[model samples]
Target: MACSLCIGTVLPILRRMRRLAVLLLLVLPHGASRGLEREAFEVYHQRRRAVSEAHPDGLILLLGYERQEAQAVRSPFRQENNFYYLTGWNEPGAALLLIPAQGDGSVYQELLFLPPDDPSHEKWHGPRAAPDDADIRSQTGFESVLPISKLATRLSRAAKKRSHVYTLFPHRAGEGKQPEPDRREKLQTHAGELPIADIRAQLEAMRAVKSEGEIRLIRKAVDASIAAHIEAWQEIEAGLYEYQILGPMLAAMINGGCLRPAYAPIIGSGPNSTALHYTAGRRRLEPGEVVVMDVGGEYAHYAADLTRTVPVDGVFTERQREIYDLVLYVQRKVIAAVKPGETLRGLTHKAKRYFDEAGRDAAGEAMGASFLHGVGHSVGLGVHDPIDFSQPLKAGMVITIEPGLYLPEEDLGVRIEDMVLVTENGAQLLSKGLPKEADEIEKLMRGR
Candidate 1:
C-alpha cells in the first residue's frame, strides 16, 4: 500500500489502542505494593545463588560507578543496574560481596559492606537511608552490613585461600578497547598479589541470565515509558521550542511512575534530528517540522528505552509519511526476528538489509552500516544492558527494538522504538500503551 493509504488506515486503530492501553493501566493492579527494598534484595539473592552454585569458592564483587567530576550533565552515580538489582543499595560509594557458603558451613557468606550514615555527612548531603537491622536482614538476605573499610582485610583473607574472584568491572566502549583503567589495574593487582583465581567470566556468565524479579521491574519501566512518550506528544506544539517539550516529556515519565530516566532524553526537532545522539534540545519548532524525541524512564531502577519520530503539526506530509512508514517496517521486521537462539549481531545484520530496502541507504553506505548502530541493547536495571550473546535469547531477557534512518544532509531522522520481553512463545511488547501511527498521534493530540 502507498504511504498515504497506510497512514490513513493504520493511524486510527493505533490511537484507539493507545487509549485502551492507558485506561487498562489506570485500573490495573499496580505491583508497587511490594516495597522496593525487598524486591531488590530478592533479585540479588537469585543472581548470587546461581553464581555461587557454579563456583562455590568464589568471591563476587559488585561495584557502582560515579559520574566523572568534570562533566556538567553527568548521570548521577547510579549503581550498575545489575549491581543495584543484587545489592538493594543505592549510594555513591558502595560495594557488595557474595562470599561463597564455604565448605557448606560458612555462617555469614553473603556480606554487604556499605557506607554507614554518618551524622555530619548526612547533615550536609541530606538524609541517607541508613542500613537498619531489618534492612540488612530482609533486603539483602545477607547476614550483616559492615563499614566499607573492612573490604580490604576481607579480600586479603579471601586471596590467601586462592579463592575465585569475579567482578562486574567496567569496560571501554567501541571496538578493541580494554576494561577501564582503575578497575583493570585493581583486578590485576588483586589477582597477582592475592593468589586468587580470576573468575570474572563466572560473574559475566551469571549476569547473562535474567531472574523473574528482573523481568517484573523491567516491565514497570516499560509501563512508565509509554506515558512519557504520549506526554511528549501531547504537549508538543507547532510553534513550541524544543527544550520546552523535553521538560514536560520527562515530567510525564516521572509522574507516570518512573524513578529515574533510563538515559539522557533525546529531544531534537527540525534539522537537529539529523544529528545522531543530538543532546542539545534547543530548536524552535515550526509547522511541517519533524521532532525526533527518543526518551525513556526507569522504574524500580530497570530501564525502558524508546524512540519515536513525529511531525509537530500532528499530521505527516507525504514525504514524512513515507519515511515514517519505512522506518516502522524495518523496526517491526527486525523485532519479528527476535526469538530464542538468535545472536544480536546476526539480528542487526538481517535488520540492516531491510533498513537498506527501506531507503535508509538512499545515498549508499556500507551494508548493515546505514543505520550505524547496534540493532538495540538489552534494557533492564540500566538503559543499555548486557545480553548473553554466547547463548540464546532466554525467556526472561528484555530488549529494545529501535531502528532508525539518519540523513544529516536531508535534515531527517526517524526511529521507532519499543521495549520487548523475550517469551517462551515469542516476544512481548511492554511499551504497549504508546501510539505509533501518524494519524493515531494526530487524533490523540486533538483529544479525540
Candidate 2:
C-alpha cells in the first residue's frame, strides 16, 4: 500500500513537469511572456555570433522599414530581411546595432532601437511597445533597447572610437526604406573616418543553412501551399477566369494559417504559360489549354515556392503528356541526385543531358534549348532568397527544384516545382504529400 501511494504521488509530479516543459517551449522567446509569436532567442543569437566572427571589433547596423504615412490604402507592414535576421523585431521603423566582442572576446552587445510609444498615435494604429517596455527585453532578448532619437548620439560616439560600420547602406527603394533625414547620411559623413562594408554576402551565406525551428516554419508554409494547389486543381474548369481559380487558392492558404502569398500568384493558361513570370490572372480558361499555377505562401515570415502545370480539363492531351513526362523525368533525376556536397550547376548539367538525350523532336531541334532559367533557387524569408547557387549543397538548406520546358511554337509550357530540404545523406521533399505525377494529378482532379 505504501509503494502504491508513492507511485501515485510520483506520477502527478512527472505530469506537471511535462506540462511546464511544454509551456516553456511555447514561451521560449525571452520577452514573449504576453504570448506573442516571437522567434526563439537562439536564432538571433546564433546569427549575431556568425556576424561577429566574420567582422570582429566591427559594428553592424541594420535598418528596418519605415511606417508609411496614413493614406487611402494601408497595407500590412513587412520587416526588413537583414534586420529581422539579427533581431526578429516585427515592428516597423526599428533599427538594430550589433557590436562585436572586444579584443579579449569579452564584450558582445546587441541593441535594438525603437520608436517611443505615443498614446495619441496608438489610438489610431494600436498600442506599440516603447523602448523601456519590459516586453522589449523579453521578446527580443537584446542586451539593450533605446529610443530612436538616441541613434544619432550613439553613432557619433561610435565614430569617435574609429569603429568600422558594416551595413547595407546604399539600399534600393522598396527594399527597406529608412527614416527621414536618413541615418545613412550620418554614417557616411559623421563616421567618415571608418570604412563601411556591405556585409550582405556574409549574411547570405549564414542564412543558407536552416535551423530546426526555421525548418518547422518552412514546413508549415509548404503544407499550406500544397493545400492551396490542391484547391486550384480541383476547382479549375473551362470558361473560368484565372482569378476565379485564385479565389479558392487564397482562401485555402489563408484558412490554413498563411499570412499571404509568397510571390505574385502566377496563373498562366495556354499561350500565357509561355511567359516565364506571367502575373495576369485574368485569362479565361479554354477546353484544350493547359494552365500553370506557380503559387506559395508565407508562414511566420518564411516563404515557400511551388509550381504545377495542370490541364484545364481533367485529363492531358497526348502531346501535353509527352512534354509533361519529359519534364517529370528530368525532375526526378535531379531530385534523386541531390545530396550533401553536390553542386546545383552539376545537377542542372545532368538535367540538360537528359533533356538533350531523350527530348529531341523529330526535326533534330533539341527540345532542351527551351529549358530556360536555372533549375532551382533557395527559398526562405524571401521567395528567391539570396544564396550561392554554385556552392555545394549542405544539410539544413531548403531550396526549390523547378525544371520547365517552354515551347512557344506549340503554345505549350510545362514546369514542375517542389521545395526540398537538404539532409545529412540526401534530400527530403518538404512537399511530399503533394501529387506531382500526371497520373496522380489526373486522379485527384477526376475525383473532384
Cα lDDT listed for each candidate: 0.67, 0.79
Pull out the clashing pairs in model 2.
30-138, 31-138, 31-139
lDDT of each residue in 370-434, candidate 2, tens digit only: 88878888888888776666899899999888899998887899999999999998989999878
Provide TM-scores for the models: 0.80, 0.86
Regions of model 2 farther than 4 Å from truth: 1-38, 69-74, 104-106, 169-186, 189-192
**Alpha carbon lDDT of residue 70, candidate 2?**
14
Root-mean-square deviation (CA) per prediction: 8.0, 12.7
Return the top candidate by TM-score: 2
Show the colliding residue pairs in model 1: 44-86
Model 2 clashes, total count: 3
lDDT of 1 at 313: 77
Candidate 2: C-alpha lDDT? 0.79
